[model samples]
Target: ERFRQVIWPGNSTTVPKGWEIPTNGKKLIVGVPMKKGFFDFVEVKRRSINNAETILSGYSIDVFEAALKKLPYSVIPKYVYLKSPVNYD
Candidate 1:
């Protein structure tokens, strides 16, 4: 998701007059804090993808699902990742 710097009392392009509003470059810009490498969600997602790959090596999700099914529903996987339709030939 993109962060917007919509102006108050006006459209997103312009702010209201006589308003002592301060932006501090935070509303428009994307980041967590301290100007670290994670200045946006994309960087965070990329890091998570890399980390998951390392932890999930030699592990199959199907096996995990089978084990989960043997357990109670409360202990089963929550919010499973499902495939979505994509444009293809």
Candidate 2:
């Protein structure tokens, strides 16, 4: 027999009998824009010695992290630094 569980936000903390919690191992890739104007929103910096080392921070990242905490399932976010001076056109 297959069992399913439904978790409502702020409803209850107890798990129902015979219900199994779902697990996801896949990671979600998130792109952060590299802009020169607004450093408060998002900022991406690479080390001079090792280009592979990236440092990400700012207000936008904080907001995104807060939203992720509200989700019922766990999500792993892989941040990718986008090219600077991005043009939509």
Candidate 3:
């Protein structure tokens, strides 16, 4: 079901002549920004179980992960914790 071409980093020739090489990396870095307020839009929560494992779950996170899975090729994203929401300006 994978309809996209898989090209590793530093190996651009694997891409088709007319196709553009996608981002290079086995795991992509995804930043999840959350506001300080407890809104439902983008709220990030971290849970620790006996200090063994850390788990992140929220409405925004679930949507982001689901979108990634729909891609034709494999894309594993490593979530980066942002202390505060991102400011584009």
Candidate 4:
């Protein structure tokens, strides 16, 4: 049920306004805090993800790394591959 709500958010996959997560729930909650990821395709929604894999993109990554170095590492998105569009969707 949770998987259907996120990850593949097509039409009808939505959350109502002003709702909050349960504080005392026993079930595991995998949280992805990307605000863009919640509403649309995370790729098209976030240009930074595309820029990360392109030429001359290291500078941005460096700044982010420098700021977060003290924090623990988490699963992060890396822009490794890019494909041009053949036809507009």
Report the number of the highest-TM-score candidate. Answer: 2
Q: What TM-score goes with each of the models?
A: 0.19, 0.64, 0.54, 0.21
The digit string of per-residue lDDT tens for model 4 on 29-89 reads 3222232222332332234755543232334445554665544433233333334434434
> Model 4 lDDT vs. the true structure?
0.38
By descending lDDT, how would the candidates be arranged?
2, 3, 4, 1
Candidate 3 per-residue C-alpha lDDT over 1-89 given as tens digits, one digit per residue, 9 for 90 to 100: 77766776677647444223355655778876655764564665556655445466667778888997777666677877676746745
Candidate 1's residue-wise lDDT over 1-89, tens digit each?
A: 99977766535566535313433322222212222232232112223644453111113444554675564332423222222324222
lDDT of each: 0.35, 0.74, 0.65, 0.38
| Model 1 residue 33 lDDT score | 20
Clashing residue pairs for model 1:
none
Give the TM-score (vs. native) of candidate 2.
0.64
lDDT of 3 at 69: 73
Task: Tell me how far the alpha carbon of residue 27 in candidate 2 is from the true structure, in angstroms, after superposition.
Answer: 0.8
What are the clashing pairs of model 2? none
Clashes of each: 0, 0, 0, 0
